[model samples]
Each structure stands twice: as C-alpha cells, then as structure tokens.
Target: MTNPTANDKWFQDRAVEQIHMDQLKRVELFNGRAAMLGIVIGILTEAITGSGIAHQIGLGALVDGYAACRTQFLPFCF
Candidate 1:
C-alpha cells in the first residue's frame, strides 16, 4: 500500500508547482498588455510629433522599458 504521508507530500509538491505556473502565466499576460499599450502610445506620440524616427525609437524604448519593469518588479506586481 502507498504511504499516506508520501502521497500528501506529492500533492503538496504539485500544488506548489501549479501555483508557480499560474504566477508565470499572469506575468506573461501582464507583459503582453504592457507591450500593446506601449505600442499604441508610441504610435500616437509619433502621429502627434510627425516623425517616423520618433515612432520607431519610442516604440522600442517603451516596449523594452515595460519588459524591464516586468522582470524587476514582478514580485510587487503579482
């Protein structure tokens, strides 16, 4: 017969793993949202500024900034 204590430990481990996976999924979701928002904001800024160069630079910078924030402030976020 399987030991109840071992079975409980297995379930506990699985729960921990599932929690980690959920957190990761949330992080990915937030990151995607941040990137999309950055893109929209960047496009609007470029349109207002009337500069194609600004559009490219702004988009890249905003996306990278969001990614950096996600990595550095993930704990605070979720």
Candidate 2:
C-alpha cells in the first residue's frame, strides 16, 4: 500500500555528506588562521625578549656580543 521507491534515501544521504564536508572545510580554515596567528605572536615575543636580553649584554662589545650572537641568534633563526 506504500510506495517505498518514492521515498529514496539517496537525497538524505547526500545532504548529510554535504553538511559534513562543509564542517570539515570550516575546521581546516580555522586551523590555518590559528597557525598564522601563532606564528605572529611567536615572532613578536622573540623580538621583544631577544632584543631586550641582547641590549643588556652589550650588543656590539665583541666578546660578549659575538657570544650572544652565536648563542641567541642561532637558536632564534633556526
């Protein structure tokens, strides 16, 4: 007495899949944005802390300067 073929579930399945895919894309976008923000914050933090420490050590005084350059610059650059 019922027409099962008229109630095809394919459309429902497709709708669900599309929703999931959209959510995945949004998550990926958020992750990319968060990574970019993290990199900026990290660089700013390093710039502030590194320069402050280097200044205290005497930036151009050969002995301490070269040592600081080697110890600090190397780690930060890498």
Candidate 3:
C-alpha cells in the first residue's frame, strides 16, 4: 500500500500503534532518538579523521578564550 488512509486498519496498527501516547514515554523516546543521532554524527566525523570531532574542527582556541571566565575550565588541552 503506497498511501494508507487514517481510517484504514493497517495504518492504525502499523503507525499509530507504535507511538507512545504518555508524556514520559514520549520524552524517553525523543531522548533516545537524540542520543542515537549524536552517536551517529560522532562516529561518522571520527571515521573521517583519527581525532575527535572537536579537535578535528580546531575548537581548542575557542575554549581557551573562555577558560579564564570560569573557575572550572573546559578540558580541551587535557
């Protein structure tokens, strides 16, 4: 079926049935999805270069400027 109507039983069973209606479950689902997206992006960027994505993009200089503003510094160097 190319396009299933809302009234169709298959659509209800296949699509709507899979969704989490509860607020907490929906938040957990979204969090999981976001984590998966981050993991994929991290791995892809890492595969392109041997270094972590932040270092590959030269983010240390940006952090160095902000380090003194905070007692706890960003761990770019260490």
RMSD of each: 12.8, 9.0, 11.2
User: What is the C-alpha lDDT profile of model 1 across 9-51, one tens digit per residue?
Assistant: 9999999999999999999999999999998887887788766
What TM-score would every model get versus the actual structure?
A: 0.64, 0.55, 0.41
> What TM-score does model 2 achieve against the real structure?
0.55
Stretches off by above 4 angstroms in model 2 are: 1-7, 51-78
lDDT of 2 by residue, 1-78 (tens): 756665557677888999999999999999999999977776776587774433444653333546656677444433
Ranking by TM-score: 1, 2, 3
Candidates in descending lDDT order: 1, 2, 3
Residue-level lDDT tens digits of model 3 in 1-78 = 455564587867766656645666889899999999988888898898766756656764444555534534544443
After the best TM-score superposition of candidate 2, give how far the Cα of residue 69 lies from its true spot, in angstroms. 20
- In model 1, which runs have C-alpha deviations exceeding 4 angstroms? 53-78
In model 3, the runs with Cα more than 4 Å from the true position are 1-21, 53-78
Kindly give the stretch of ten consecutive residues in candidate 2 with the minimal lDDT sum: 53-62
